[model samples]
Target: MTKPRVLLADDHRMVAEGLKSLLAEEFELAGIVEDGLALVKAARELNPDAIVADISMPNLTGIDALVQLKRDNPQVRVVFLTMHRNPAYARRALQIGALGFVLKHSAPAELVLAVRAALEGRTFIAPDLAAEVFRTPAKKEAGPAEALTSRQREILQLLAQGHSAKQIGAALNLSARTVEDHKYRLMETLGIENNAELIHFAIKHGLAP
Candidate 1:
Protein backbone atom coordinates (compact mmCIF):
# COMPACT_ATOMS: atom_id res chain seq x y z
CA MET A 1 0.00 0.00 0.00
CA THR A 2 1.17 3.53 -0.76
CA LYS A 3 1.70 5.85 2.20
CA PRO A 4 -0.32 9.07 2.34
CA ARG A 5 1.47 12.33 1.70
CA VAL A 6 1.31 14.75 4.64
CA LEU A 7 2.02 18.42 4.98
CA LEU A 8 2.68 20.08 8.34
CA ALA A 9 2.12 23.66 9.39
CA ASP A 10 3.18 24.87 12.83
CA ASP A 11 5.05 27.93 14.00
CA HIS A 12 6.73 26.14 16.90
CA ARG A 13 9.81 24.40 15.57
CA MET A 14 9.87 21.92 18.41
CA VAL A 15 6.27 20.91 17.87
CA ALA A 16 6.89 20.45 14.17
CA GLU A 17 9.93 18.35 14.88
CA GLY A 18 8.02 16.14 17.27
CA LEU A 19 5.23 15.62 14.74
CA LYS A 20 7.67 14.82 11.96
CA SER A 21 9.30 12.16 14.08
CA LEU A 22 5.98 10.72 15.16
CA LEU A 23 4.62 10.49 11.63
CA ALA A 24 7.82 9.38 9.95
CA GLU A 25 6.99 5.72 10.18
CA GLU A 26 3.44 6.08 8.91
CA PHE A 27 3.34 8.85 6.31
CA GLU A 28 5.34 10.56 3.65
CA LEU A 29 6.15 14.15 4.62
CA ALA A 30 5.52 16.31 1.59
CA GLY A 31 6.90 19.42 3.25
CA ILE A 32 6.95 21.61 6.32
CA VAL A 33 5.84 25.22 6.58
CA GLU A 34 6.36 27.41 9.63
CA ASP A 35 3.41 29.79 9.24
CA GLY A 36 -0.09 29.71 7.83
CA LEU A 37 0.77 31.85 4.81
CA ALA A 38 3.55 29.47 3.93
CA LEU A 39 1.23 26.59 4.64
CA VAL A 40 -1.18 27.84 2.02
CA LYS A 41 1.61 28.19 -0.50
CA ALA A 42 2.96 24.77 0.32
CA ALA A 43 -0.44 23.11 0.07
CA ARG A 44 -0.92 24.59 -3.34
CA GLU A 45 2.50 23.51 -4.48
CA LEU A 46 2.81 20.10 -2.83
CA ASN A 47 -0.74 18.76 -3.16
CA PRO A 48 -0.47 16.66 -0.03
CA ASP A 49 -3.03 13.96 0.85
CA ALA A 50 -3.41 15.36 4.36
CA ILE A 51 -2.27 18.27 6.52
CA VAL A 52 -1.65 18.66 10.25
CA ALA A 53 -1.60 22.25 11.37
CA ASP A 54 -1.54 24.48 14.41
CA ILE A 55 -4.40 26.91 14.97
CA SER A 56 -2.38 29.94 16.10
CA MET A 57 0.22 30.76 13.49
CA PRO A 58 1.96 33.89 12.30
CA ASN A 59 0.67 35.89 9.26
CA LEU A 60 -2.43 33.69 9.07
CA THR A 61 -4.12 31.24 11.43
CA GLY A 62 -4.25 27.59 10.43
CA ILE A 63 -8.04 27.74 10.16
CA ASP A 64 -7.80 30.57 7.68
CA ALA A 65 -5.21 28.69 5.70
CA LEU A 66 -7.41 25.62 5.68
CA VAL A 67 -10.25 27.69 4.27
CA GLN A 68 -8.09 28.67 1.36
CA LEU A 69 -6.77 25.16 0.93
CA LYS A 70 -10.28 23.77 0.84
CA ARG A 71 -11.23 26.30 -1.75
CA ASP A 72 -8.41 25.13 -3.94
CA ASN A 73 -8.53 21.45 -3.11
CA PRO A 74 -11.64 20.37 -1.27
CA GLN A 75 -10.66 16.71 -1.22
CA VAL A 76 -7.58 17.02 0.93
CA ARG A 77 -8.05 16.02 4.55
CA VAL A 78 -6.75 18.14 7.42
CA VAL A 79 -6.16 17.38 11.10
CA PHE A 80 -5.58 20.23 13.51
CA LEU A 81 -2.94 19.84 16.19
CA THR A 82 -3.36 22.52 18.81
CA MET A 83 -2.42 23.19 22.40
CA HIS A 84 -5.82 24.66 23.23
CA ARG A 85 -8.27 22.34 24.97
CA ASN A 86 -11.15 24.76 24.50
CA PRO A 87 -14.26 23.14 23.12
CA ALA A 88 -15.10 26.29 21.22
CA TYR A 89 -11.93 25.91 19.20
CA ALA A 90 -12.81 22.33 18.42
CA ARG A 91 -16.30 23.36 17.38
CA ARG A 92 -14.93 26.00 15.06
CA ALA A 93 -12.42 23.60 13.51
CA LEU A 94 -15.11 21.07 12.76
CA GLN A 95 -17.41 23.73 11.37
CA ILE A 96 -14.62 24.78 9.02
CA GLY A 97 -14.25 21.21 7.67
CA ALA A 98 -11.34 19.89 9.70
CA LEU A 99 -11.28 16.07 9.73
CA GLY A 100 -9.72 15.81 13.18
CA PHE A 101 -8.87 17.91 16.20
CA VAL A 102 -6.07 16.65 18.44
CA LEU A 103 -4.82 18.35 21.56
CA LYS A 104 -1.06 18.82 21.70
CA HIS A 105 -0.75 17.18 25.13
CA SER A 106 -2.61 14.05 24.11
CA ALA A 107 -0.66 10.82 23.79
CA PRO A 108 1.30 10.52 20.56
CA ALA A 109 -0.65 7.39 19.71
CA GLU A 110 -3.79 9.47 19.33
CA LEU A 111 -2.23 11.33 16.41
CA VAL A 112 -1.78 8.14 14.42
CA LEU A 113 -5.39 7.23 15.03
CA ALA A 114 -6.50 10.71 14.00
CA VAL A 115 -4.59 10.50 10.73
CA ARG A 116 -6.03 7.09 9.93
CA ALA A 117 -9.54 8.20 10.80
CA ALA A 118 -9.24 11.30 8.63
CA LEU A 119 -8.01 9.28 5.67
CA GLU A 120 -11.00 6.97 6.15
CA GLY A 121 -13.38 9.95 6.04
CA ARG A 122 -14.15 9.75 9.73
CA THR A 123 -13.97 12.66 12.18
CA PHE A 124 -11.73 12.43 15.20
CA ILE A 125 -11.46 14.52 18.36
CA ALA A 126 -9.14 14.02 21.28
CA PRO A 127 -10.71 11.48 23.62
CA ASP A 128 -10.69 13.85 26.57
CA LEU A 129 -12.49 16.55 24.59
CA ALA A 130 -14.81 14.31 22.57
CA ALA A 131 -17.81 14.94 24.82
CA GLU A 132 -17.46 18.68 24.93
CA VAL A 133 -16.59 19.00 21.26
CA PHE A 134 -19.69 17.14 20.10
CA ARG A 135 -22.13 18.62 22.61
CA THR A 136 -24.20 21.56 21.45
CA PRO A 137 -23.78 24.69 23.47
CA ALA A 138 -26.79 26.03 25.31
CA LYS A 139 -26.51 29.25 23.34
CA LYS A 140 -24.67 30.01 20.12
CA GLU A 141 -22.93 33.07 21.41
CA ALA A 142 -19.97 34.37 19.45
CA GLY A 143 -17.01 35.36 21.55
CA PRO A 144 -15.63 38.90 21.26
CA ALA A 145 -12.64 37.83 19.20
CA GLU A 146 -14.72 35.43 17.16
CA ALA A 147 -16.76 38.35 15.90
CA LEU A 148 -13.71 39.69 14.08
CA THR A 149 -12.75 38.76 10.54
CA SER A 150 -10.01 36.18 9.96
CA ARG A 151 -7.42 38.90 9.31
CA GLN A 152 -8.42 40.75 12.41
CA ARG A 153 -8.20 37.59 14.49
CA GLU A 154 -4.74 36.87 13.10
CA ILE A 155 -3.58 40.39 13.87
CA LEU A 156 -5.13 40.22 17.32
CA GLN A 157 -3.30 36.99 18.10
CA LEU A 158 -0.01 38.51 16.95
CA LEU A 159 -0.62 41.61 19.05
CA ALA A 160 -1.40 39.49 22.06
CA GLN A 161 1.85 37.61 21.46
CA GLY A 162 3.70 40.93 21.99
CA HIS A 163 4.41 41.85 18.37
CA SER A 164 4.35 45.54 17.55
CA ALA A 165 2.18 46.89 14.74
CA LYS A 166 5.21 47.37 12.48
CA GLN A 167 6.34 43.81 13.09
CA ILE A 168 2.90 42.42 12.52
CA GLY A 169 2.55 44.44 9.35
CA ALA A 170 5.79 43.02 8.04
CA ALA A 171 4.73 39.50 8.90
CA LEU A 172 1.30 39.84 7.30
CA ASN A 173 2.53 41.83 4.29
CA LEU A 174 0.45 44.84 5.36
CA SER A 175 1.53 48.37 6.01
CA ALA A 176 2.32 49.50 9.54
CA ARG A 177 -0.46 52.07 9.35
CA THR A 178 -2.88 49.41 8.16
CA VAL A 179 -1.92 47.16 11.05
CA GLU A 180 -2.46 50.04 13.50
CA ASP A 181 -5.80 50.79 11.87
CA HIS A 182 -6.82 47.16 12.40
CA LYS A 183 -5.83 47.42 16.04
CA TYR A 184 -7.92 50.55 16.42
CA ARG A 185 -10.91 48.91 14.78
CA LEU A 186 -10.55 45.77 16.87
CA MET A 187 -10.47 47.91 20.03
CA GLU A 188 -13.63 49.72 19.04
CA THR A 189 -15.43 46.53 18.06
CA LEU A 190 -14.42 44.74 21.26
CA GLY A 191 -14.99 47.74 23.56
CA ILE A 192 -11.37 47.62 24.54
CA GLU A 193 -9.42 50.67 25.66
CA ASN A 194 -5.84 49.66 24.92
CA ASN A 195 -3.39 46.94 24.05
CA ALA A 196 -3.56 45.50 27.56
CA GLU A 197 -7.32 45.21 27.31
CA LEU A 198 -7.07 43.75 23.83
CA ILE A 199 -4.59 41.14 25.03
CA HIS A 200 -6.87 40.31 27.91
CA PHE A 201 -9.79 39.93 25.56
CA ALA A 202 -7.75 37.69 23.25
CA ILE A 203 -6.78 35.37 26.10
CA LYS A 204 -10.34 35.31 27.38
CA HIS A 205 -11.63 34.34 23.95
CA GLY A 206 -8.97 31.75 23.01
CA LEU A 207 -7.45 33.94 20.31
CA ALA A 208 -4.13 33.66 22.11
CA PRO A 209 -2.62 30.86 24.12
Candidate 2:
Protein backbone atom coordinates (compact mmCIF):
# COMPACT_ATOMS: atom_id res chain seq x y z
CA MET A 1 0.00 0.00 0.00
CA THR A 2 1.11 3.58 -0.60
CA LYS A 3 2.21 5.70 2.37
CA PRO A 4 -0.13 8.37 3.70
CA ARG A 5 0.03 12.02 2.68
CA VAL A 6 0.50 14.34 5.67
CA LEU A 7 0.38 18.11 6.06
CA LEU A 8 2.49 19.47 8.92
CA ALA A 9 1.66 22.86 10.51
CA ASP A 10 3.59 24.67 13.24
CA ASP A 11 4.77 28.23 13.69
CA HIS A 12 8.28 27.21 14.75
CA ARG A 13 10.35 27.12 11.61
CA MET A 14 13.01 24.80 12.95
CA VAL A 15 10.43 22.41 14.38
CA ALA A 16 8.34 22.29 11.22
CA GLU A 17 11.41 21.67 9.06
CA GLY A 18 12.78 18.99 11.37
CA LEU A 19 9.49 17.11 11.66
CA LYS A 20 8.93 17.30 7.94
CA SER A 21 12.26 15.61 7.22
CA LEU A 22 11.72 12.97 9.88
CA LEU A 23 8.19 12.14 8.81
CA ALA A 24 9.12 12.31 5.17
CA GLU A 25 11.24 9.21 5.63
CA GLU A 26 8.07 7.25 6.34
CA PHE A 27 5.31 9.10 4.54
CA GLU A 28 4.57 11.60 1.80
CA LEU A 29 4.98 15.08 3.27
CA ALA A 30 2.22 16.89 1.43
CA GLY A 31 3.03 20.32 2.83
CA ILE A 32 3.90 22.44 5.89
CA VAL A 33 2.41 25.70 7.19
CA GLU A 34 3.58 28.29 9.74
CA ASP A 35 0.36 29.98 10.83
CA GLY A 36 -3.15 28.82 11.70
CA LEU A 37 -4.87 30.63 8.86
CA ALA A 38 -2.30 29.41 6.41
CA LEU A 39 -2.81 25.94 7.77
CA VAL A 40 -6.52 26.14 7.00
CA LYS A 41 -5.91 27.48 3.54
CA ALA A 42 -3.19 24.91 2.83
CA ALA A 43 -5.44 22.07 3.87
CA ARG A 44 -8.22 23.29 1.63
CA GLU A 45 -5.86 23.72 -1.29
CA LEU A 46 -3.68 20.64 -0.87
CA ASN A 47 -6.31 18.15 0.24
CA PRO A 48 -3.88 15.99 2.17
CA ASP A 49 -5.10 12.74 3.68
CA ALA A 50 -4.11 13.87 7.18
CA ILE A 51 -3.13 17.14 8.85
CA VAL A 52 -0.92 17.47 11.93
CA ALA A 53 -0.94 20.94 13.46
CA ASP A 54 0.32 22.56 16.61
CA ILE A 55 -2.50 23.64 18.92
CA SER A 56 -1.46 27.28 19.29
CA MET A 57 -0.89 29.12 16.03
CA PRO A 58 -1.04 32.75 14.98
CA ASN A 59 -4.25 34.30 13.55
CA LEU A 60 -6.76 31.47 14.09
CA THR A 61 -5.28 28.98 16.61
CA GLY A 62 -4.82 25.30 15.81
CA ILE A 63 -8.08 24.23 17.40
CA ASP A 64 -10.02 26.87 15.52
CA ALA A 65 -8.40 25.84 12.26
CA LEU A 66 -9.23 22.24 13.00
CA VAL A 67 -12.86 23.17 13.59
CA GLN A 68 -13.06 24.97 10.29
CA LEU A 69 -11.29 22.21 8.43
CA LYS A 70 -13.61 19.59 9.83
CA ARG A 71 -16.60 21.65 8.84
CA ASP A 72 -15.36 22.21 5.31
CA ASN A 73 -13.76 18.83 4.73
CA PRO A 74 -15.39 16.35 7.02
CA GLN A 75 -13.54 13.44 5.44
CA VAL A 76 -10.09 14.81 6.23
CA ARG A 77 -8.28 13.48 9.30
CA VAL A 78 -6.77 15.84 11.90
CA VAL A 79 -4.07 15.03 14.44
CA PHE A 80 -3.08 17.69 16.96
CA LEU A 81 0.61 18.11 17.70
CA THR A 82 0.66 19.79 21.08
CA MET A 83 3.01 20.50 23.94
CA HIS A 84 0.16 20.72 26.44
CA ARG A 85 -0.07 17.59 28.52
CA ASN A 86 -3.36 18.84 29.93
CA PRO A 87 -6.14 16.29 29.65
CA ALA A 88 -8.57 19.15 29.16
CA TYR A 89 -6.91 20.08 25.87
CA ALA A 90 -6.90 16.48 24.75
CA ARG A 91 -10.60 16.25 25.47
CA ARG A 92 -11.29 19.51 23.72
CA ALA A 93 -9.36 18.41 20.62
CA LEU A 94 -11.47 15.29 20.49
CA GLN A 95 -14.64 17.31 20.90
CA ILE A 96 -13.57 19.42 17.94
CA GLY A 97 -13.36 16.33 15.70
CA ALA A 98 -9.61 15.75 15.84
CA LEU A 99 -8.69 12.14 15.19
CA GLY A 100 -5.81 12.21 17.70
CA PHE A 101 -4.03 14.47 20.18
CA VAL A 102 -0.32 13.64 20.52
CA LEU A 103 1.92 15.53 22.93
CA LYS A 104 5.22 16.74 21.42
CA HIS A 105 7.35 15.23 24.17
CA SER A 106 6.52 11.76 23.00
CA ALA A 107 9.22 9.78 21.25
CA PRO A 108 9.56 10.46 17.54
CA ALA A 109 8.41 6.92 17.02
CA GLU A 110 5.24 7.66 18.87
CA LEU A 111 4.46 10.52 16.53
CA VAL A 112 4.85 8.22 13.54
CA LEU A 113 2.62 5.69 15.23
CA ALA A 114 -0.03 8.30 15.91
CA VAL A 115 0.01 9.51 12.31
CA ARG A 116 -0.47 6.06 10.83
CA ALA A 117 -2.98 5.08 13.49
CA ALA A 118 -5.01 8.16 12.79
CA LEU A 119 -4.90 7.30 9.10
CA GLU A 120 -6.36 3.93 9.99
CA GLY A 121 -9.15 5.49 12.11
CA ARG A 122 -7.49 5.04 15.51
CA THR A 123 -6.86 7.73 18.12
CA PHE A 124 -3.55 8.08 19.94
CA ILE A 125 -2.29 10.17 22.86
CA ALA A 126 1.25 10.19 24.17
CA PRO A 127 1.47 7.23 26.49
CA ASP A 128 3.48 8.91 29.25
CA LEU A 129 1.46 12.09 29.13
CA ALA A 130 -1.73 10.10 29.20
CA ALA A 131 -0.56 8.31 32.34
CA GLU A 132 0.51 11.47 34.14
CA VAL A 133 -2.72 13.17 33.17
CA PHE A 134 -4.86 10.52 34.81
CA ARG A 135 -2.59 10.64 37.82
CA THR A 136 -3.06 14.37 38.38
CA PRO A 137 -2.70 14.66 42.12
CA ALA A 138 -6.06 15.12 43.78
CA LYS A 139 -4.38 17.31 46.38
CA LYS A 140 -3.24 19.50 43.52
CA GLU A 141 -6.65 19.11 41.96
CA ALA A 142 -7.06 22.72 40.94
CA GLY A 143 -3.87 23.58 39.12
CA PRO A 144 -3.04 27.20 39.82
CA ALA A 145 -3.82 28.05 36.20
CA GLU A 146 -7.06 26.14 36.55
CA ALA A 147 -8.11 28.51 39.31
CA LEU A 148 -8.30 31.40 36.85
CA THR A 149 -11.68 31.98 35.24
CA SER A 150 -12.29 31.84 31.50
CA ARG A 151 -11.94 35.63 31.39
CA GLN A 152 -8.49 35.34 32.91
CA ARG A 153 -7.33 32.89 30.23
CA GLU A 154 -8.57 35.33 27.64
CA ILE A 155 -6.61 38.17 29.23
CA LEU A 156 -3.50 36.05 29.44
CA GLN A 157 -3.68 35.33 25.73
CA LEU A 158 -3.93 39.02 24.92
CA LEU A 159 -1.04 39.81 27.24
CA ALA A 160 1.11 37.39 25.27
CA GLN A 161 0.15 39.33 22.17
CA GLY A 162 2.07 42.30 23.62
CA HIS A 163 -1.03 44.19 24.71
CA SER A 164 -0.58 46.68 27.50
CA ALA A 165 -2.68 46.21 30.61
CA LYS A 166 -4.81 49.23 29.65
CA GLN A 167 -5.22 47.90 26.14
CA ILE A 168 -6.20 44.49 27.44
CA GLY A 169 -8.69 46.13 29.78
CA ALA A 170 -10.21 48.12 26.95
CA ALA A 171 -10.57 45.05 24.78
CA LEU A 172 -12.02 42.95 27.56
CA ASN A 173 -14.19 45.77 28.92
CA LEU A 174 -12.44 45.98 32.26
CA SER A 175 -10.42 48.60 34.13
CA ALA A 176 -6.65 48.67 33.84
CA ARG A 177 -6.45 47.78 37.52
CA THR A 178 -8.57 44.72 36.84
CA VAL A 179 -6.24 43.71 34.05
CA GLU A 180 -3.29 44.16 36.38
CA ASP A 181 -5.02 42.04 38.99
CA HIS A 182 -5.56 39.28 36.47
CA LYS A 183 -1.98 39.52 35.30
CA TYR A 184 -0.67 39.26 38.83
CA ARG A 185 -2.93 36.32 39.52
CA LEU A 186 -1.89 34.57 36.29
CA MET A 187 1.81 34.99 37.06
CA GLU A 188 1.25 33.54 40.52
CA THR A 189 -0.89 30.68 39.31
CA LEU A 190 1.12 29.72 36.21
CA GLY A 191 4.41 30.24 38.03
CA ILE A 192 5.44 32.80 35.44
CA GLU A 193 6.20 36.49 35.78
CA ASN A 194 6.39 39.32 33.26
CA ASN A 195 5.14 39.45 29.69
CA ALA A 196 8.12 37.55 28.33
CA GLU A 197 7.57 34.62 30.64
CA LEU A 198 3.86 34.58 29.83
CA ILE A 199 4.59 34.49 26.10
CA HIS A 200 7.06 31.67 26.60
CA PHE A 201 4.49 29.75 28.60
CA ALA A 202 1.77 30.21 26.01
CA ILE A 203 4.03 29.10 23.17
CA LYS A 204 5.38 26.21 25.19
CA HIS A 205 1.92 24.86 25.84
CA GLY A 206 0.95 25.32 22.17
CA LEU A 207 -1.49 28.07 23.22
CA ALA A 208 0.39 30.68 21.15
CA PRO A 209 2.61 30.62 18.13
Candidate 3:
Protein backbone atom coordinates (compact mmCIF):
# COMPACT_ATOMS: atom_id res chain seq x y z
CA MET A 1 0.00 0.00 0.00
CA THR A 2 1.17 3.53 -0.65
CA LYS A 3 2.04 5.26 2.60
CA PRO A 4 0.14 8.39 3.60
CA ARG A 5 2.05 11.55 2.67
CA VAL A 6 3.06 13.71 5.63
CA LEU A 7 4.60 17.18 5.79
CA LEU A 8 6.55 18.24 8.87
CA ALA A 9 6.82 21.86 10.05
CA ASP A 10 8.88 22.96 13.04
CA ASP A 11 11.41 25.73 13.62
CA HIS A 12 13.61 23.47 15.67
CA ARG A 13 15.81 21.40 13.37
CA MET A 14 16.47 18.76 15.96
CA VAL A 15 12.80 18.27 16.73
CA ALA A 16 11.89 18.06 13.05
CA GLU A 17 14.63 15.52 12.47
CA GLY A 18 13.33 13.38 15.27
CA LEU A 19 9.75 13.61 14.03
CA LYS A 20 10.98 12.74 10.54
CA SER A 21 12.52 9.55 11.87
CA LEU A 22 9.41 8.65 13.84
CA LEU A 23 6.96 9.14 11.01
CA ALA A 24 9.09 7.84 8.14
CA GLU A 25 8.36 4.24 9.04
CA GLU A 26 4.59 4.60 8.83
CA PHE A 27 4.19 7.42 6.32
CA GLU A 28 5.90 9.00 3.33
CA LEU A 29 7.71 12.21 4.26
CA ALA A 30 6.42 14.70 1.71
CA GLY A 31 8.46 17.71 2.89
CA ILE A 32 9.94 19.59 5.85
CA VAL A 33 9.53 23.32 6.53
CA GLU A 34 11.01 25.43 9.34
CA ASP A 35 8.34 28.09 9.67
CA GLY A 36 4.60 28.59 9.28
CA LEU A 37 4.93 30.55 6.02
CA ALA A 38 7.03 27.79 4.50
CA LEU A 39 4.56 25.25 5.82
CA VAL A 40 1.72 27.01 4.05
CA LYS A 41 3.70 27.12 0.81
CA ALA A 42 4.77 23.50 1.01
CA ALA A 43 1.27 22.28 1.87
CA ARG A 44 -0.02 24.03 -1.22
CA GLU A 45 2.66 22.63 -3.49
CA LEU A 46 2.89 19.14 -2.04
CA ASN A 47 -0.73 18.53 -1.07
CA PRO A 48 0.27 16.14 1.64
CA ASP A 49 -2.34 13.88 3.20
CA ALA A 50 -1.54 15.30 6.62
CA ILE A 51 0.71 17.96 8.13
CA VAL A 52 2.58 17.73 11.44
CA ALA A 53 3.38 21.24 12.63
CA ASP A 54 4.61 23.31 15.52
CA ILE A 55 2.26 26.07 16.66
CA SER A 56 4.79 28.77 17.60
CA MET A 57 6.66 29.00 14.31
CA PRO A 58 8.07 32.29 13.03
CA ASN A 59 6.61 34.67 10.38
CA LEU A 60 3.15 33.17 10.90
CA THR A 61 1.96 30.87 13.63
CA GLY A 62 0.76 27.36 12.79
CA ILE A 63 -2.81 28.16 13.85
CA ASP A 64 -2.80 31.34 11.76
CA ALA A 65 -1.29 29.51 8.81
CA LEU A 66 -3.91 26.80 9.14
CA VAL A 67 -6.62 29.44 9.14
CA GLN A 68 -5.32 30.71 5.81
CA LEU A 69 -4.84 27.22 4.40
CA LYS A 70 -8.33 26.15 5.35
CA ARG A 71 -9.76 29.11 3.50
CA ASP A 72 -8.60 27.51 0.25
CA ASN A 73 -8.70 23.87 1.33
CA PRO A 74 -11.02 23.20 4.23
CA GLN A 75 -10.27 19.50 4.32
CA VAL A 76 -6.57 19.92 4.93
CA ARG A 77 -5.57 17.60 7.76
CA VAL A 78 -3.20 18.95 10.42
CA VAL A 79 -1.76 17.63 13.66
CA PHE A 80 0.04 20.12 15.88
CA LEU A 81 3.04 18.89 17.89
CA THR A 82 4.20 21.55 20.30
CA MET A 83 5.64 22.13 23.77
CA HIS A 84 2.72 24.31 24.79
CA ARG A 85 0.76 22.44 27.42
CA ASN A 86 -1.91 25.08 27.80
CA PRO A 87 -5.37 23.68 27.26
CA ALA A 88 -6.54 27.01 25.86
CA TYR A 89 -4.10 26.71 22.97
CA ALA A 90 -5.32 23.21 22.28
CA ARG A 91 -8.91 24.39 22.46
CA ARG A 92 -8.24 27.20 19.99
CA ALA A 93 -6.39 24.86 17.65
CA LEU A 94 -9.22 22.32 17.57
CA GLN A 95 -11.81 25.04 17.20
CA ILE A 96 -9.94 26.22 14.11
CA GLY A 97 -10.19 22.72 12.57
CA ALA A 98 -6.99 20.99 13.55
CA LEU A 99 -7.62 17.24 13.76
CA GLY A 100 -5.02 16.58 16.40
CA PHE A 101 -3.14 18.38 19.16
CA VAL A 102 -0.20 16.40 20.57
CA LEU A 103 2.32 17.72 23.01
CA LYS A 104 6.00 17.53 22.11
CA HIS A 105 6.96 15.80 25.32
CA SER A 106 4.50 12.99 24.55
CA ALA A 107 5.17 12.88 20.80
CA PRO A 108 7.36 9.81 20.74
CA ALA A 109 4.45 7.73 21.90
CA GLU A 110 1.51 9.76 20.63
CA LEU A 111 2.37 11.62 17.40
CA VAL A 112 2.00 8.74 15.00
CA LEU A 113 -1.31 7.86 16.57
CA ALA A 114 -2.48 11.44 16.24
CA VAL A 115 -1.40 11.61 12.60
CA ARG A 116 -3.16 8.38 11.83
CA ALA A 117 -6.30 9.56 13.53
CA ALA A 118 -6.29 12.84 11.61
CA LEU A 119 -5.81 11.03 8.31
CA GLU A 120 -8.77 8.86 9.23
CA GLY A 121 -10.91 11.95 9.86
CA ARG A 122 -10.82 11.56 13.61
CA THR A 123 -9.95 14.19 16.22
CA PHE A 124 -7.26 13.53 18.82
CA ILE A 125 -6.11 15.62 21.75
CA ALA A 126 -3.27 14.59 23.96
CA PRO A 127 -4.63 12.67 26.92
CA ASP A 128 -3.29 15.24 29.31
CA LEU A 129 -5.22 18.04 27.65
CA ALA A 130 -8.31 16.27 26.39
CA ALA A 131 -10.27 16.68 29.58
CA GLU A 132 -9.74 20.38 29.95
CA VAL A 133 -9.99 20.99 26.21
CA PHE A 134 -13.45 19.49 26.08
CA ARG A 135 -14.76 20.51 29.47
CA THR A 136 -16.02 23.88 28.27
CA PRO A 137 -18.82 24.51 25.82
CA ALA A 138 -17.88 24.21 22.18
CA LYS A 139 -18.79 27.82 21.47
CA LYS A 140 -17.63 30.91 23.27
CA GLU A 141 -17.65 34.63 22.67
CA ALA A 142 -14.69 35.90 20.64
CA GLY A 143 -11.78 37.05 22.75
CA PRO A 144 -9.75 40.20 22.14
CA ALA A 145 -7.20 38.20 20.16
CA GLU A 146 -9.92 36.54 18.14
CA ALA A 147 -11.27 39.93 17.11
CA LEU A 148 -8.17 40.81 15.05
CA THR A 149 -8.25 40.26 11.33
CA SER A 150 -5.92 37.65 9.86
CA ARG A 151 -3.63 40.30 8.35
CA GLN A 152 -3.55 42.17 11.62
CA ARG A 153 -2.66 39.00 13.49
CA GLU A 154 0.14 38.30 11.02
CA ILE A 155 1.55 41.77 11.54
CA LEU A 156 1.20 41.38 15.29
CA GLN A 157 3.21 38.15 15.23
CA LEU A 158 5.94 39.80 13.19
CA LEU A 159 6.01 42.82 15.43
CA ALA A 160 6.24 40.67 18.55
CA GLN A 161 9.19 38.92 16.94
CA GLY A 162 11.04 42.26 16.76
CA HIS A 163 10.71 42.90 13.03
CA SER A 164 10.57 46.56 12.01
CA ALA A 165 7.80 48.10 9.96
CA LYS A 166 10.00 48.16 6.85
CA GLN A 167 10.91 44.48 7.17
CA ILE A 168 7.31 43.52 7.88
CA GLY A 169 6.12 45.57 4.93
CA ALA A 170 8.69 43.88 2.71
CA ALA A 171 7.54 40.47 3.88
CA LEU A 172 3.85 41.22 3.44
CA ASN A 173 4.31 43.23 0.18
CA LEU A 174 3.00 46.41 1.87
CA SER A 175 4.70 49.77 2.32
CA ALA A 176 6.38 50.61 5.61
CA ARG A 177 3.80 53.32 6.22
CA THR A 178 1.00 50.83 5.71
CA VAL A 179 2.63 48.43 8.11
CA GLU A 180 2.92 51.19 10.70
CA ASP A 181 -0.70 52.07 10.14
CA HIS A 182 -1.68 48.48 10.75
CA LYS A 183 0.41 48.47 13.92
CA TYR A 184 -1.37 51.48 15.29
CA ARG A 185 -4.78 50.17 14.30
CA LEU A 186 -4.22 46.78 15.91
CA MET A 187 -2.90 48.51 19.04
CA GLU A 188 -6.01 50.61 19.24
CA THR A 189 -8.22 47.58 18.73
CA LEU A 190 -6.48 45.71 21.51
CA GLY A 191 -6.48 48.77 23.78
CA ILE A 192 -2.73 48.55 24.21
CA GLU A 193 -0.71 51.76 24.28
CA ASN A 194 2.88 50.66 23.70
CA ASN A 195 5.13 48.11 22.05
CA ALA A 196 6.10 46.37 25.27
CA GLU A 197 2.46 45.77 26.20
CA LEU A 198 1.72 44.65 22.67
CA ILE A 199 4.54 42.12 22.80
CA HIS A 200 3.33 40.91 26.18
CA PHE A 201 -0.21 40.53 24.88
CA ALA A 202 1.03 38.66 21.82
CA ILE A 203 3.04 36.27 23.94
CA LYS A 204 0.17 35.77 26.31
CA HIS A 205 -2.22 35.00 23.48
CA GLY A 206 0.15 32.70 21.55
CA LEU A 207 0.69 35.20 18.72
CA ALA A 208 4.37 35.73 19.40
CA PRO A 209 7.17 33.67 17.94
lDDT of 2 by residue, 1-209 (tens): 78789999998989999888879877898898997768888998999989888987765578767877888887778888888777878766877788778878777888888888889988787887666544545553554544656566667666777778898777657999999988898888888757788888766655555
- The digit string of per-residue lDDT tens for model 3 on 151-209 reads 99999999999999999998888999999999999989999999999999999888986
The C-alpha stretches of model 2 lying farther than 4 A from their native spots are 131-209
Pairs that collide in candidate 1 are: none
Task: Give the winner by TM-score: 1 or 2.
Answer: 1
- Ranking of candidates on lDDT, top first: 3, 1, 2
List candidate 3 stretches off by more than 4 Å. 137-142
Q: How accurate is candidate 1 locally (lDDT)?
A: 0.88
Which 10-residue span in candidate 1 carries the lowest summed lDDT? 139-148
lDDT of 1 at 121: 86
Best by lDDT: 3
Residue 180 C-alpha lDDT in model 3: 95
Stretches off by above 4 angstroms in model 1 are none
Q: What is the lDDT of residue 187 in candidate 2?
A: 87
Query: Of the pair 1 and 2, which is ahead by lDDT?
Result: 1
TM-score of 2: 0.65
How accurate locally is residue 50 in candidate 2, as Cα lDDT from 0 to 100?
Answer: 90
